[model samples]
Structures are given as structure tokens and as C-alpha cells.
Target: MSSDTKGALLDVVKGGVVSVTLFAAFLNLPVIGLPAAALTPFPALYFGLKRGNRAGIGLVLLAAVLVALAGGPEASVLYLGQSALLALALGWGVARGYSASRSIATAVLVTLGLAAAAAAVYSVASGVDLHERVVAGIRESISQALSLYEKRGIKGDELKPFRDALEQGGEVLSRLYPALLLIGQSIVAGINVMLLRRFANRLPAPIRIAPFNSFRNPDYLVWVAIAVGFSLLIDNNVVNAAALNVATVAGFLYFLQGLAIVRHYFETYSVPALLRYLFYAMLVMQAYLAIAVALLGLFDLWADFRRPRKPKNL
Candidate 1:
């Protein structure tokens, strides 16, 4: 065979191999639906890496379908729109000769826009008007909260303050749909960064790896350990779920650490047979864990819009 023909055939085979491998690996996870939804950004990145954005439109569409099917009809629009933005951002970067920081900034902005657009589209398309429905849902939620408060038999005056607060919150949920979209966009962005770094090589060069000095950063470790440790202690009911809540956040961090380990090992020296097996094993394990934590995070975000946020001490 001609060298050109041989090389083209090899490339095709490799692409197919990678696609099947990634899809299968992802499918094995329990939270395939949500992670797959969050993963809407990945196929675009893959396509951009392999064939650029114009050619990647079809691939991104396919991932959108996979993601949408899992998130349900309500979120299908948002997922597909985000996927489209991801493709555009990646393609635009390649075409414009964007610096790494510029590409990242573009991706972040596009992700926010796409997420907000998706929310607006979904809100309008769903049978109920967003303003009315959000108000209703918030009221129903507040009533339930008050009923529980009553059962606790709190002093009547104490109940008044709590009830007043929820009444105010109900109004907020009704009008602050934009803020909610922003929160979702932030979440989707984090997932994209994770996927891009772990699989698509979309991050700035000198890709980070493990034995990371950041790992030993005392504050980070201490706070995370405390979060996870506290969650474990509280794992009783709705409150206990915060443990899994802690798990999702903590697990994603570990997932990144594990990915770095694999990268570092490869960068540091030759890949031994045993290490290769170990690396593959870790990848599979982390994929499952990432899925679980992502699902946990999903519920956490859904039930409580604000998880305790802290100002980062730079």
C-alpha cells in the first residue's frame, strides 16, 4: 500500500479506537446521565483537536444527543446549546491563533452564555411560565419548610423569623433565574475543565500532573478533610446526604489528583508494564468515582443552591 494510504488508514483506526474506548468507559458509570450531560463539552474538544470545529459540529451534535437523553427533556435544550458553544469556542481558538489564556477565557464566557440561553429556552418551552412556576415552586417549598418548623414546635416568634426569611427567598427564586443560570454555568465550566485536561489536552501546555505541591497545601487539605469528615459524621438523612455532598466535591478533587498521577508518571520516566496496568486501573476507578461524586453534587446543587462558599485566601 502507498505510504499515504497506510497513514490515513492508521489514523482512522486510531480515531475509532479512541471513540469506542471513551464511550464504553463512560457508559460503565452509574451517573452516566449527568456526567455525560456535563461531558457535553468533551466531544467538541475532541473534534477540535482531531479535525477542528467546522468538521466537529457533527461530533458535538452526537454528544449533545447522548447528554440530552440522560438529562431529560427539560434540560435537553441547555445541554445541546452548551455543546454547540463548546464547539464554537474550541474552533474559534484554533482559527484565531488564540493564546491559551485567551482560549480559556473565551470558553468560560461562551459557557456562561450558552448556559443562560439554555435556561431561558427551557423556561419558555416548558408549559408553565418561568416566573409563575418558580414562584409557585418556591411557595410550595416554603410551606413544606414551615410545616416542618411547626412540627419542631419552635417558639412562635422564632417561627416568624424563619417564615419571613423563606417568604423572601421565594421571591428571589422567582426573579433570579439569571443567577441560577450563572451557577449552573459555573458548574458546567468546572466539569469542562476536568474533561479537557483529563482527555482532550485543551488546557495550557505544560499540562499539570501529580506530586503536585498544591496537594500539600495545608489549608486546602485541612478544609477538604474537614468537609469530608463532617459529611461522614452527618450521614443520617437529608442532612447525612451532605456526606455524599462532601464526597462529590472531594471526589472530583481526587479525580484530578489521580489524573495528575498518571500524567506525572508518564512524564517522569518510562512506563513500566505494572505501572501501565495500574494506570489503566486507576482511570477506570476514577471514572466511576467521578460519576458518583458528580451525581452527588447534582443533588446537592438542586436541593440547596448555596453550599457554604468561602473566600479563597490567595
Candidate 2:
């Protein structure tokens, strides 16, 4: 075989190996499992950007087959449908030289679309309410925990309050799960893109992504957020639920934009690196502060906090 052909084949092999390792880590790891799963697409993304799309897709198929053989049909489908497809979108975005914001948005949308499709398919096939199943699983877990606590001699009033709280929590979780899921999957895709940026220059095909600190969402999104907020006043369960989901997603997106604005000011003012780290820590630990940041982000659309003042002629 020609030297070029041999090198291409080796790349394919390498991509397959990386995919399998990451997928295995995703399946086997416990607390860190989601992060491990998020990395499953990186191999295919790298190869797709480096080689042609066709070759990259071929590598993904090979990886999926390997996963199916080793982990079973369910594993193969999950890896292919979720992680593999995400990687493909990321690779396609980078290869086409999309901006960092656009690329990340594309990846997040792809994740949401694939996730919705999978859930719909599963719901139809099983004839079960997915939300109810999830809530039931949560309740079961709470029940098991409470039982263990009871067995350990912590019954009576102490357990009663906790049990009530846990049940109530489960109900809230079921109601808000759709929003939670969207935020979670978006975060996963966003983080993966951030991580991938660090290695982009070292890959076979170098791609430069703008720093996340400079990211911004369009201003028109604010109107959608306002509409969703108004919908909350309506009494219809369907409208309220739909509004809740949209509002939650918009809130998180604006929070990110707010963060970027903070980063910009810190950079512009030459703020100390340590202080910037502390700022982020405070935002994460304080729920109210995070909400405040989101408000700042939304208001920034009109406030124009980041706009530079024009220099006056002397």
C-alpha cells in the first residue's frame, strides 16, 4: 500500500482505539461517568477535522461496532446516537471554520435534538411515560435510603420529615426534569468544546477557537425569555410547562453570557488572576449571586456594559 494510505489507516486505528477507551470509561466509571462519556466524541471529532468527513464517519462506525460487540446493542446505540453524533457536529463545525459561539451553539442544539429523538423513540417503543419512570426511580431510591435509615434505628419523627421532604423533592424533580436535562446536556457539550479547544492546535488539522470568555448570545433571545416569563401567568399546564423549559434554558444561556461579560471587565481592568478565580468560586457557591449574574447578563443587552467609549479628539 502507498505511504499516504498506510498513514490514513493508522489514523483510523488510533481513532477507533481512543473511542473504545473513552466509551468504556464512560460506562464503567461512577461519579465521573458523565465527563468520561462526554469525551467519547473527541476522537472522532479530531479525526474528522484532520481527515475528511467520510473517513471520520467511518471511524465512528468502527467505534460503534466495537462498543456493540463489547458492551452490547444498548451501549452501541447510546454511544452512536448521543456521543458519536455530537462529535460529528463538533468536527463539522470546526472543519467549516465556524466561530466559537456558533460551533458551541450547533453542538448544543445537536445534543438536544438527538436526546429528544432518543427519548421519543424509547417512549413510543415502551409505551411508558418517561417522566413518570424517572420520578418513580427517584422515589424508589429515596424509599430505599429511608428504609436503611430506619433499620439503623433512626425511625420515628426524625425520619418522617426527611421522608416527606424526599418525596416532595422527587415531585419537583419530575416536574422540572425536562429543563434539567436540557441544561445538563448543553453543559456537557459546552464543556467538551472548551476542552477540545486546548488540543485543537496539536491535532493533524489545526483549528483555532475563540476563548469562551468572549462568548455572547444574540440580544433577540431576551424577547423570547420575556415571552416565556409572561407565559408563567397562564393557568394551562401545557403552556406553563413549555414556558418553564424555555425559560430555564434561556436563563442558563444568559448566565453564561454574564460570565463572559465579567471576564471581559476583569481582563480590561487588569484584575488579578487569583481574584478572578475567587469571583467564579463565589458564583458557583452562591445561588443568589448566580441569579444576579443572569439578570446582569439579560440587562446587558440594553445596558451595553462591554461597549468601549469612543476616544474624544483633544
- Per-residue lDDT of model 1, residues 114-229, tens digit only: 66566689777885576566678779989999999899997588899998898887765555544454445545654554455565354333333222312211226436656667
Model 2, backbone clash pairs (residues 3+ apart or across chains), number: 0
Model 2 ranges off by over 4 Å:
148-153, 203-208, 310-314
Residues 1-314, model 2: lDDT tens digits: 99877877788889998889988987898777767777778778877777778878989999999999999999998888778888888877877888867776787688778778889998999998987788789889888989998999888988998889888887767678888877776676777678778877777766768887777789789889989989999999999988888888899989988888898889899999999899889998999999999988888888888888899999
**Which candidate number has the best lDDT?**
2
The superposed Cα distance between candidate 2 and the true structure at residue 149, in angstroms, equals: 4.2
